[model samples]
Target: MFIVSLIFFVLFLPSVSVSYANTLFLHIEGKNDTLSIYAETGTQTKSYQVKRLQDIEALYPLLQRRQIDRNSFEQLLRELGIEVFEPIHTFIESSSEIGFVMAENLVKLPLDLLYVKEIPLFLQKPITYSFTKINSQNLQFSNTLSALIISDKTADPENGTYFLKKLLPSSAEYYDIKDINLTQLESIQTKDVILISAHGRIRFDNNDCIGLGDEQISPSHLARLSPKLVYLDSC
Candidate 1:
């Protein structure tokens, strides 16, 4: 009787372990409230709601072409809300251990990251985004370049101070405007590059975007100063 009982316990032990291991619980926090999604060993407890269905549908053929498994493909479909005609068994012959491991270990459900692949989509599509490197190429042009940083003590003191440090290099001659006065403008005589790092609005007439200062310098005032390159850091 003892030997029979031992064999039975060993046979049931693996199933019990797998049952506990396969269960995955996830919590997701949204703007107003929180939500949860649970999944078992080859199935999901809840369905995923997709905002942009068209883009995901367009990409379905590509996923099928790659021959991903039924569970994974279905999971992707549910999350992305795209339909696939092919059977799960035909597409994915064998399930991946790596995929299972990843799914089992995932404590946090991917919150909008998978669906909203690009964040602040507008910000990412800027016309130009480039950084200046402080090296040999920059050194040769430092003397020819001059910067003007405008700052009021109230708006952004830390950012103004930080920009002042970055723009005021040892090799370059730069100016910081604590107060925008007519005398201050008069002091800068032969400046090549004029960087207006302050909050301002710009107006376009023919082909040029004219810079207008807020409360301090109007559109009429900015029209007076003439510089080859004018960089307005503020909007």
Candidate 2:
């Protein structure tokens, strides 16, 4: 896990091609009853160590429940000792985009979704997660480029695209599930951007798929496209 964390940090280091100001990369790993923290920026890098708490295994399951146990959740927060990890919190505040890589059971507990001191981390800034190494070359794009948003009636791509209109070029396109097919996504060019706000599910066999109302798009299908950006807003 530590090795994987190092590989992630190396991707955005100032020495890397994608290094940007106010960008923070954090990796949290828990193993052998200890929690390891690693954080880096364009100018600085820091590491910390803390003991893993008892019943930490239960925290993720509680979060997964439809009705969360507030008291238990808050107790988990207190047990995690966010205060003792003050340096990480302070670093996160100064960064714009956060790249979080969690190891083992830690991945089930979404750190960005948590509310610490009445402020959720995701609300504070743009937080992105990764399960594998991030390629810096594929991560850069023009914010003003035209976009293509695909969604179903349930998720409402209209409102979602409208909310993102400022970031997209005037020629941006919107397609409801009924209007497009999985094959169409392969024709996307490098100058285009794609956003899918639809239903998504991961099967036990590790086949990741997103619903298109009438069909599904899989990871293999997505790999064949070369878009400037592809945002998956579904669960």
Candidate 3:
């Protein structure tokens, strides 16, 4: 079984004068029975195929528990034909960056950090999609950037805050779980970035929920956020 989906955005770049012209690219994902690739470079378009892996839903929980075996996961990637889906490697060929969005379980085996046939995807190309797309509208002509990090060390001892600090600019601000809440989340305006490093789970109803500092937040709570970039590194 297979289904394909394609999404487009006309990103604008700012100079002394603003222009609407931009390049086109593709995004691909193989979730369960479907392997989808959407490509467009202004005029060209194509589709590719790969066999989907089984027991993906089962594997996700192992990932959440951090008990997944790399050898097995890589084998799954091989069956899924990461090499065949070359677009995954070159989607940001022009800009040399890739931005990723993943559910909490998938975060355990982050594709960007995996090895595809001996080549680490990170080494093949940079991942910048989040920074590029999220800030596309707000930071084109701005000089200032800010970040808010909400993490619960008790729930996640991975020290996501430490790693995020290393990834984000030194100018970015930091906040522990104790410093954030639903009220603050609703009112605080994250001008540049929002990173959540905590435990997450998918509800029976298919809603993605995150364990924040003082309270648990559901997808509905996050729907109102408008940060230029959001990195949910949990689940």
Best by TM-score: 2
Show the colliding residue pairs in model 1.
Answer: none
Ranking by TM-score: 2, 3, 1
Give lDDT tens digits, candidate 3, residues 88-191.
44433543333443333332233443445566555665443321322233244233556667777864477756655666656466767777778877786534
lDDT of 2 by residue, 32-128 (tens): 7676778887788899876653345444445445676677666666545464346677777677777776664565445654454556556677765
Return the lDDT, model 3, position 34: 53
Best by lDDT: 2
Tens-place lDDT per residue, model 1, 52-141, is 433432332333253556566445545542221111222122222101111222212222213212231112221111121011111133
In model 1, what is the error at residue 175, expressed in angstroms?
5.6
Work out the TM-score per prediction. Answer: 0.31, 0.64, 0.58
Off by over 4 Å in 3: 1-24, 27-32, 40-45, 53-59, 82-95, 98-115, 120-123, 128-143, 154-173, 202-205
Model 2 residue 80 CA deviation (Å) reads: 4.6
Question: What's the ranking of the predictions by lDDT, best on top?
Answer: 2, 3, 1
Which candidate model has the greater TM-score, 1 or 3?
Answer: 3
lDDT (CA) per prediction? 0.32, 0.59, 0.50
Query: Total clashes, candidate 3?
Result: 4
